[model samples]
Target: MKLLAGLTILMIVFVVFGIHTQQQILGLASDMQEMVPNISREINNENWDAARNDTARLLEQWNEIQDRWDLFIVHSEIEQVELYIARILSYLSSEDKAAALAELAALNTQLSHIYRKEMFNVQNIF
Candidate 1:
């Protein structure tokens, strides 16, 4: 029947969409991960200016990605990253290197959480 055919098409589309969404999320996380080393170096060297600039750039990239991600991901996960970025900025302003690094670690964890949750794993599906 036409109805059965239509339903099958819809299911295929859904699967494709889910796959694409997962890829996009993973890509965004990879981009962020790539910048981590430079940021870490800046932090370790106590180069506040460079660290601030790098973190700002990272935050900007995340903002751009988050706009598209909002359509696919839960807002809370997005908000957690946003909050972490803000906290990192604050710590940088105060020259709290320890706190800034801790916050960066938290941000990394959040990014990983987002990617893992969207993965097609048994834990997520069940």
Candidate 2:
């Protein structure tokens, strides 16, 4: 009876941790997604300075969250995001609108994929 109670408590704690992890991942992904469009618009308008600042801010935010993210997300996925951000920064520096936009799209897609993959759904269970 004591063993059974302990197991049940452990399961409850695991479930709570899983829910919190999912929420954090989703929230971070959503925040990053929201910034992408604004950066894209800045790029479209040829506002390089604003775009650069936004990209820097994005990188800063990523840096702040990445250690926590490393605990729950695959390292390769995290690395891919870092790579995309670096490429986007490079493109922005060169004033390459096409390339910058392309990278931003890729970054958005990656973030969407992360959240979708992390979602606690039937599809994910399989």
TM-score of each: 0.94, 0.97
Error of 1 at 34 (Å): 2.3
Model 1: per-residue lDDT, tens digit, 88-110?
88999888989999998898888
For model 1, give the 10-residue run with minimal summed lDDT.
33-42
Per-residue C-alpha lDDT of model 2 across residues 73-108, encoded as one tens digit per residue = 999999999999999999999999999999999999
Whose lDDT is greatest here? 2
Model 1 TM-score on a 0 to 1 scale:
0.94
Candidate 2, superposed: residue stretches over 4 Å from native? none
Off by over 4 Å in 1: none
